[model samples]
Target: MLRYPAVEISKGPRTVPWGTPEVTLDVSDVESCTTTFWVRSAKKQFIHRLKRREREESEDSNEDDYVPYIPIKQRKKLKVRQAEKRLGRIGLLKEQEAGSTSEGTSEGGNEGEEDEGVNLGPKSKFSLLDQHSDLKRKAEARKETAREKILKEEEKILESVAEKKALMAVSELAKGIEYTDPIKTGWRAPGYILKKSEHEHEKVRKKYHILVEGEDKPAPLTAFREMKFPKPILHGLKKKGIQHPTPIQIQGIPAVLSGRDMIGIAFTGSGKTLVFTLPIIMFCLEQEKRLPFINNEGPYGLIICPSRELAKQTNEIIAEFCGYLEKDGFPPLRSALCIGGLPLNPQLEIIKRGVHIIVATPGRLMLMLEKKMFVLDICRYLVLDEADRMIDMGFEEDVRTIFSYFKGQRQTLLFSATMPKKIQNFARSALVKPVTVNVGRAGAASLDVIQEVEYVKQEAKIVYILECLQKTAPPVLVFAEKKQDVDAIHEYLLLKGVEAVAIHGGKDQEERTQSIDQFRKGDKDVLVATDVASKGLDFPDIKHVINYDMPEDIENYVHRIGRTGRCGKTGTATTFVNNGNDETVLLDLKHLLIEAKQKVPPFLAAKELENEKYLNIGGEAGCSYCGGLGHRIAECPKLEALQSKQVAGIGRRDYLANSSADY
Candidate 1:
């Protein structure tokens, strides 16, 4: 490096060395270096130096960049303190001068300006101590906030660890499940019925286990014959292959015959409607036989369904069933279907005609009740078909209001595939000390029906569904959330050469009926629908139930799948999922499957149910056992011993608790 003059640096104002390297600097009237220099060598050197000086000045300027300047108020205080320091020095100098002058004057006794009381300059003083105190306080506050944040992070970590441990425990317990003795089911697969038999119903009360203690009661056929039902009615039922009574008709007929308050829990397609309908028709016929009025207004029975589709279906079925009874000589059973979509005027006219059995939705029933369009005061029998679905969809209030119109101990028959707690509560409140009749397994996934749910990403849903339709080649029932989604999916399939039609709440009643009819007739192989199709639509060959969007609860899933594999047909349900959407609900579903001891998917084992080994799965919540989301423990086979430990503890606890407690 070339030798250069030593340059001194200071943070505060300080004197630069003179006479060593100062080329005259013109601060007052400085000109450009090119214009001010006289000698070329000196000018060249000066120009070079000027450039170097600029570089050096920039270097120094960056030094203070990190340190923010004090605010104007602080700067003013600093200046005031500096001024006071200067004034003190000046006063000291003046005092010395005054003493010297006095001595020189030999007692002249004249003090110059009377010393001005040693004036401290400026208006205020700056306290370095106070500034330091403020800085320390700020630092302490920042430290406290940081500490709190650390504690929260630790808490989150601890919670995550606890969840992991719990999941591991569930996983271990799942491994010991043995799957054998598979029952070969039939072609017509029905939904889950109550687990208890007539004798057992009185014993088990939890989780939808209804009991019907079958007595040596008069058979429904004997009752029909004794009541004088004609050969035409008996022949139609016989020709339709009526032998022994269905459990519902067996249990329900007697209760309704007794004219007492009753709640019957029967399986779907188990002649649930006829349980109450046959009795109502017989009773109405009996009333007609006794009264024999030319024209009378009566709503002897009210059957409530959750959906317009179900309402219409029930009405049609009842009409057919009762037609046989009518021709056999029960006063012709006139019925009106009260559901949304068809003009209410038609329903009103039918109601005005004095129908015996009114099949309606909760909302429509409430509206008819408010208009006083029908008389329900004389309604002796009340039936809530699919009562579980009604409560799930927030229709309890409306159902209760309908009940409010009817008085006197009424025979209420509640039929649902699965009974949730809410449904049980409703039965308790609405029905008198009723006989609980459970026909099959409580909360059992359909045994005869083979159920499979395919998890797919939302974005890939359309293609995945198309692939299934292409591969499976069976009548597919696709479900979407929105009416718009229904149209979109329908159009997409149509474009792909698949005959698909959309059905949703937005579709006019006729259009929905037509769409469903078209599918049923095999005119369309695939039908896209909303929750309206989730219940009470019987398509014998619905080979697949595609959930383009997952439902929020397990009950809906069960019902959706129940649409297919009906009459013993194996059905598959494909569900499209996205992150954060279906996790908890999927967990609930997995719990359902595990509780049922169904087969677990292998992917769930290696990925989902393992610690730190979760499948960003194809769907939501990591499995409770395997840490995999959107699948059951059986599906998550790989989550091993760690998960099992916690499970053993829980099992022991439950066993001890249940065994020790007195019922």
Candidate 2:
């Protein structure tokens, strides 16, 4: 029997009557507690001893009548916890032991457990793990597969969710606003709405495309706003009203920023300058913040352009970008131009003052190094702009000598309008695992340039050019094959009162730079130049490029035409190919014109048509049977035998006739 405790409350009669008015009750006992009352009890079953242990050794199980009770909190003991931890460790050890079983042994265990932290034992069944990989590979493999599947599913679900959320949010925002889409309204369903999965798939695709030979097409950048350059660089770009990066700049910038050696192959004026300069500025900014002060004893970065003007132009762009960066926390990146035309004393003083970057021509930079004006020990970034042109300018040995000072630590970026075997070998020796970006075909002109070919006598080119200039706008670039021709053309143009100047290798460096400045500033209407001004001179106003004399190579022709049609502006390129030695050039020009969708010349077609089915035999013997300079129809031995037989038959018939007459 079980007893229960209860409380009893007793109230005495009230002093005042309840029926009458104004009656008060004597409830002093209301606050009192009385413990005396009848108790309620229930019959309880009790087993004096606890339930017998149901151990295998002693089985006195009374499980039916027994009930188990537990406190909300668990009881802990050091020995029990130690035992549990030891058990866990033992379990892990067992897993490892199972994995480490010899391949020859037949130890059977789970294949799903982790196999690590164990040396292979002769007893383990999977001793060598397929005999290919080490101990961690199997676990890593399983984890990798599982992680890949999970990530794939997660990416799909997350993309779909995010896209739906974004689209629905846009729809919500547009509810109060007027929106009219001819394709998305009423019965029409756009691809983004109808085929939602297609749009969902591209969110996780790669950001960069691989450009390799035979598959050399790189997609264009649709917007510069999406690239999200830093504030300083964006400020510079905005000040210049540059809203988009050219195709080469789009791909080339990221590669350079990733700290990889690069070989950039793009057409001239395709914004290759910004490809190296932007990254160089950013690098300088980072180093500036990292170090207490920049050491100007030698430049941290070096830019080796082929010409003084290219170096000067690059230096000006760097200064512009650095000016924008100065407003922010970063100190402006100081740059100095050390080209040949400039005074060596000024350059030496600039080096003494210290510079973050030195933009110099190869020849001048080599001389500075020989004079010990600056050191290359701290210089970590080197840029070779117009690399192929530098090689052509006979700076190959100078470049190699300068690179010897770099000591394999510097990052070398080689940018060129063309890729020659020399550039290839130089890159192999200088750059370390470089990423090559060839935007268009190397040694090819921009499609933005409209090309026209005029076949005429070399002496009458001045007349043809005069006519072309009269028809076209000002600031035309005229390329001559020889310096004499350039001078003659310039003289004739001046005599005719055409505002023109000439530039070539024959001109002093100062004169060349001055002429280019005049051309760039529009002070001169026409600039007669050789291949010297054919590359990397950024004159935004050049509307026409006339090749007064055909170049020996199509590469030079491409560079000549590239002087115009810069940065998406349409311009014209006219080439004068004379009849004598220009036939070969015309042959290439015709194919190039046709390929680029330009107008093909009738003379090129007529010449090719005349020689299409026949080879020029000249005076050389080609075929002995027909005495033809070229191969005639194949000689047939069977036909010759048939002819001999016919002649013998005729002789036999005549002999028979004579014998009959004699008889």
Candidate 3:
């Protein structure tokens, strides 16, 4: 023990004492005391006291309000000091433990005295290793609990899905409709009627280019007698001068009669209407013979046409065949024609009288259905004539809405001269397991038609139309792009004393009907019209079709020229082109001519060399969409417009607005 010195302390404001009045120091010897106490200066002691006061004040204040700035190097130095301090404390504890163990064995009494002065906290008995192991065990238990929770949720979801499926199956069964796999059980062709050798069927299909896609397709019948039709139906066929079935009728009729959905694609006027007409008549006749339909309960078969004129024409064909059935002592099979621009009361009266077959356009038929005028309760046979034209006329939505009203499954038949990919996709979704019957290419021009292109000036086209008509005899058809053009051409031809009659969408239903009847009866030499007459109109002995101006779309061009060459009869089509027309349409026309093996004009042929790279890329001749040889599917304008319309949320428009008047 050592005593330093006694100092007097003052409590004045300016003068403050350093410590108490007496100072005591403890040391084993004076040498150690001098070395330890003399090493620290007064200035160092004063600075350490000031730093202690600053640390205490900072901790007592709110730390969030202000943070003291520290340089990067100073911060690093402070961290190093803290680490060293921690290591030093740990080393000191280790050294004390080692010394205590060694000294306790040698001097037990002295160790006991030293242990009495030491103090241990409450957690001194717990080892760090034991605490770490306990924490890890708890974490593993939490993970196992979470995994079990997730597994239970997934199992619940699966059970619910299976339950829903079972309920749906039960509901379908209660309705007496079991939905089978369309691929497996859809084919219903009679195997006994097929030929023995498959190669014989292949040869017939190859000769006619009749491509059929589906499972278990029916073999084509070469003669009408092999179809095993009723005598009355056969007599009707004989009356119409029928000898053999066309390629479409050969494949399409069997597929439809076997209760399979079918898509029939062929050139214009290859007897497409007869394919569906005969089957519907047979269906109606069967229904009538089994049990005659009472009032408001029949119309077991329906035919949906795109245009009024086509519907009227189809109704006439059905009426003629029905007449033959009645003459042969069969039940009276009545048919009704429902279309726009006509008296609704007369149509409704015919429907109320219990017709067997109803031919209707989308606008009028949809109106009747929406107003609860009639229902397709027993109508199991459905036919869509000119399906592509209906889509172009924007009846796609109405057709879908009509489909929703059906109570049960029905045999669907779609007949069109052209089948684009979009419509084909729609058919796939709409009809279950449909058989595709294609004669030649989908949009290819009729092989029987002779295409002639002339580069007539804008001012001289009207004058040149007379010269073109002179190439063929009377009963010629003239198509123009606009109703104004149709009117102009009709006046010019009448002024020249050509006995021409005009018809367009602007005309009344009665006037249009009269004009068509006059032209069919040979009372008018030429029938001038817009595109409304270009599709699904059958005119007998039409020797020449003259296009006063080129149509906008290549598909329209194909339909326009198809009027002349029909029913395997050869005819001529003369189109007038000029520089004012679109380049894309002109290019497509040029390629169409080349594909048909017709003469290409000098102006169109000149650009063939420049587009050589784009030609023959896929080794295919024409476009699969519109049958245009000038461009591939990537650059198709029709596809682009359709996609844009879809993106803009403008689906098919109303039929009356878009297509009723052909405006």
Reference-based lDDT, each prediction = 0.57, 0.61, 0.73
Q: Candidate 1, residues 261-304: lDDT per residue as tens digits?
A: 55565443455655666666666666567764233376777888
Worst 10 residues of 2 by lDDT: 39-48
Candidates in descending lDDT order:
3, 2, 1
The TM-score, computed over Cα atoms with residue i paired to residue i, of candidate 3 is 0.69
Clashes of 1: 40
In model 2, which regions exceed 4 Å deviation?
A: 1-228, 292-296, 607-663
Give a tens-digit lDDT track for model 2, residues 1-663: 222222223335423222333433233432242333321111111111112222522444544555344222322332343465567764564455456534322122233322212223343543455644654677787766764564455345334322121111133234533222111101222233334453332231133232422122222233454344567778678778787777677667756665667788887778899889987887777777667334455588899876556677889999888888887767766788887655777766777766788998766777778877788878878888877665433455667668656532667788877664334544554455666787765665688999988877967878878898965789888988777888899999999999998876655667877887887788989998877676687887689888898775566688789888987788998888867654445565666676678887787767553332222222222211212222211221212333566567642211011111111
How many residue pairs clash per model? Answer: 40, 6, 0
Error of 2 at 176 (Å): 71
What RMSD does each model have against the real structure? 23.8, 35.4, 19.3
